[model samples]
Target: MTSLPEDPSSPIGESARDTAVRRLQEAFSEGHISHEELDGRLHWALTAKTHGELVAALAALPAEKAGTTSTIAAAGGQIRRRGAWQVPRTLKVASAFGRVRLDLSRAVIEHPVIDIELQLGTGRAHITVPRDAIVDLEGLHTGWKDLRYKTRRSSRPGGPTIRISGMVGFGRLKVRHARR
Candidate 1:
């Protein structure tokens, strides 16, 4: 409710939050963040109390670069991808003695097909997707690991597909589709 006055002289004016929101939108357009991510950030930007808070909202965004992949490296901890997250065309997830969960139930899919590369070192990865999503687990080459898929739907035209690939070392990989 409290917004700073518009000052033309200052580069950072009352529209700082608005600019931040715009940047977030751009990120979405470029397939950087999902609708849920955008919604969460836009809410924060709109409710930001100060210029710093607005800037902080934008700072949460990952650096935008062509052919770049989003990464989640969890070491001795847990990394989660749920809610509103802008998923990348190619994502790299590495976990060492930890848990990595990716929930695509409400994710915004910019690309028709998504590739996920995982490196689990005695860790666990759990992925959940929407019922309409097509999951392909053939790319995953495992060695001394456990990979499970609970997908009921096959790949079809005009539907999003998630292609999971990568290595699992004494770890667990489970992919489940959400029920409507």
Candidate 2:
């Protein structure tokens, strides 16, 4: 059995490989690339001779953006929704490793319109909303396995509800919702 190369940077290499795979999986999930293309990229990444080469290969992949707006406000690693709710704006979120949970139960919306868009790179994510709040959700996991989601409906007209739960193994998830 031929063992994988082991160097002082083995751990880093592994980490980099994992990251690259996750990004590639995300791209594939988002329909940015075909399965064959993703497989080819993964093969190249795994066969990369140096860390720099691996990094370059990963960087070559396309990135996922959540919002349609050009102005991005990212604060404290958390991008809180801002401005008046009228035109039904979109909220885009992207993260890796740590979980990104959106609890909109406490949010007070004066306007009658809003929207949300979520993007995950890896790890776990949970999102909650009011039952009365109009929502549409979708998720895709293009890794070695499938992504998961758990949702619960509420009895209250505006009771806090959720389209919760998503787990990604070297992958990503995106959710888009519109409120009226």
Candidate 3:
């Protein structure tokens, strides 16, 4: 996935209804929705004033799946896997416009690379990595704020490579790399 350009300008102060209408119009223009469907949903979203109402309206939109499939397994939004002998393992993660939690504290791999593509809305996320592993990061992009990284030690040889890219609306991302 490609990174979205950051917009440093101030956010629009329109009401939820207005915002919904604007989003619907943009979606239609972008060919994400048909005219009749856009009209129906735009009416509902525009009339939604409360947070729950707006969420409901937005939830009616089409569903899109993110992330990748490899030796690792992901189900019900949780990822789990075990490495086998005589095989090099890799893990890839991706999330679009939602919250994603990654717990790599129990991972056991000779060599691993974690690639994450995030498109967050307003929710925050936390990512933890092994300290003894080497982490090489690349392709990190965000729309609302700068990507944040916190690590204790520097990268070492034969360690893991963590790549992140995508868009964020209003939220903070914290990544902690610690030794095992």
Write model 2 residue lDDT over 1-180, tens digit each, in one string.
012344533433566677677667666754677899888888977887665566556665665344433232232254344333222234455555555556564455432334444444554455545446644344333454354433434333543222222235564443322232
Error at 108, model 1, angstroms: 1.4
Model 1 scores a TM of 0.60
Order by TM-score, highest first: 1, 3, 2
lDDT of 1 by residue, 1-180 (tens): 134445423334456666677568777755678889889888987877766666667875766446636887978799898987888888999998999899998887786667899888887889997778888888898778667886583544556778898898888888998765
Per-candidate clash tally: 4, 0, 5
**How much does candidate 2 score in TM-score?**
0.35
List clashing residue pairs in candidate 2.
none
lDDT of 3 at 84: 29
Candidate 2 vs candidate 3, lDDT winner: 3
Model 2 segments more than 4 A misplaced: 1-88, 110-113, 139-180
lDDT of each: 0.77, 0.49, 0.53
Model 3 TM-score?
0.43
